[model samples]
Target: MVHIVVLGAGIGGIPMAYEMKDLLGPDDRITVVSNTDHFHFVPSNPWVAVGWRTRDDIMVPLAEPFARKGIAFKSVGCRRVLPQENALDLNDGSRLTYDYLVVATGPELAFDEIEGFAPQSNTISICHVDHAVEAAKRWEEFCRNPGPLIVGAVQGASCFGPAYEFAMIADADLRRRKIRHKVPITFVTSEPYIGHLGLGGVGDTKGLLESAMRERHIKWITNARTDRFEPNAVHATEIGDDGQEKAHHVVESRLTMMLPAFRGIRALQGVEGLVNPRGFVLADKHQRNPTHRNVFGIGVCIAIPPVEKTPVPVGVPKTGYMIETMVTATAHNIRALLDGKEPAEEPTWNALCLADFGDTGVAFVAMPQIPPRNVNWSSHGRWVHLAKVGFERYFLRKVRKGISEPVYERYALKLLGVKRVQEQTRETTNV
Candidate 1:
């Protein structure tokens, strides 16, 4: 009987376990090793930071669900991944061997990359549920005595959506409390523009997002490289297109939240031919590592290069849609290997995201998540906010029920329909 061990229990790991379980034989086993005992919906973290969502609202206990599905669960975490020996050194001082391994251990937050850039320091983060919980506490404190606010992503950060979402959501929250006028918001981002989003401005996102920020009176500094954060201030330099520092500014703020850069977890760092210098797993298109065929990667821990060069470093985002595709491809490919056949399935790698603004939201889809794609679309409306809320509930239910059915394909198909109909109408009218 084959044993498959999946490391991590976040958005990627939990789904990977369920999908693989469906494809494996009855005797074959699946065990999930996680650092945490519960699964939290990560995309809803911005709301958590703003106190719109609590810890219980988005979190699900994993033990019962996994047990019901006959999948072993462990929360002791991993100290190291012994790839050469096909084993893992558990934090509990035990060793677990596997016939196959899936490395879905989402990235470790690289807050130390910047001085005073973590929750314990000058800035707050919503990257983790725990951080979000703390940010919520700080949010209440900030509101009682609000001042200027700062929110954005630091340099080398790949996930830009949540930064934008949190900034807008905070704005919405302040306005509802009638304290928006007392606070000035500055969006500090490494992106070249408000909508660059590390994918080079998907379908007028630049215009749409800039307009949204203008409506909310949220000032932005693009191509900004933060140097340090002191109490009530952030030091940053604005970079020019010529790659020179155009200006240095010390922005005042009573509250700050910035999305930190991500890297592979410590356990996988510096493994020859397995990880890059930044500790991200190196995997082929089929999600299998070439150096270790039995190992696969399926989430933020995998290395994806920048979509394009910018004045400041900005990495491509692996949205939930993209990660789901990776999980599906990896699951099918592993099943193929178990059947004594070469793996053939490859992920589509498309991306779909709804960046809720607390009131209204922006939604976008990139057909391949890289440039030069077939479908690149973005839209903004209150409906996008409603859709995001619906999706959070739908996804949480999927996880709690141990449902392995793929969901993003339906969203992709719907977007495709809208895209084609719009194209045909434009052609018919010669507009």
Candidate 2:
């Protein structure tokens, strides 16, 4: 019987384990390894930071769900991935072997890249539930004594949606508390423009976001490379088209929340032919590692190039729907290997995103997240915000019940009239 190991329990990993279980034989075992015992909805983190959602509201304990699914679950975590041996070194001095391994550990927040840029340092973070819980406490204190606020993604950051979401959400929350005028909000980003969002401004996101910011009286700094976060001031370098520092500015703020660059987890770093220079897993069109045939990668830990060149580095985002496609493709490809057939399935890599402000939001669809796509659409309204809330509730229910269905394909994409996977041969797609 084949023993498949899935590393992580987040959005991609949890669904991956459930989907693999459905496809594999009764004797084929699946084990899920995660450092945390619970799964937290990442998209709701912005709301959590501002006291709308609590930790318990978004978190799902994986032990019960996995047990109900007849799957082995380990929360000890992984210390290192030994791809050559087809094994893993667990955190508690134990070794686990597997016939095939799916690496979906997600990205390690690189807050240390900038001096005093971590949640423990001068800034607050909403990347994790724990971070958001602490950020909520800070938010309450900041609201009571309102001052200037800074919010945006730092250099080399990929997930730009959360940064934009938090900025608008914070604005909305402050207005409700009647402290928005007291807090002068400044949006500091590494993108070349206001809504570049690391995908080259999806479907006039530039126009929509810039207009929204103007309406809310939010100031912005684009092509900004944050150097350091002082106690009450942020030192940044604004870059020009010539790739040189155009000017240096010190913006003072009492509160700050900046998204940091992401790198692969420490466990997968420095593995030859397995990871890129930044430690992202190198996967082919089929989601299989070029060097390690038995290994597959999905989600934020996998490498995807930037959409275009800008003065400051901006990595492409791996959105929820895009990552879902990766999980589906990996599951089918692995199943093909077990059946003694060549892997033919390929993920469409489509991006369907909902960036919610507390009351209103923007939604976009990129047929293939890399751009130069077939369907490039974006819209903004209160309905998008409602859709985002419904998504959180729907996703949590599925995880709690151990449901393996692809929610995006069945609901989100069907509503949008989009496809999930290509389902064609590698030769047909010229892969």
Find the candidate with the highest lDDT and give its number: 2
Give candidate 1's whole-model lDDT: 0.91
Q: Rate the local accuracy (lDDT) of all candidates.
A: 0.91, 0.92
RMSD of 2: 3.5
Error of 2 at 210 (Å): 0.3
Clashing pairs for model 1 are none
Q: Taking the tens digit of each residue's C-alpha lDDT, what string does model 2 give over 295-357?
A: 999999999999899999999999998999999999999999999987888999989888999
lDDT (Cα, tens digit) per residue for candidate 1, span 90-114: 9999999999999999999998888
The reply for model 2, stretches above 4 Å from the true place, is 414-431
Measured against the true structure, the TM-scores of the candidates, in listed sequence, are: 0.96, 0.96
In candidate 1 the C-alpha lDDT for residue 152 amounts to: 94
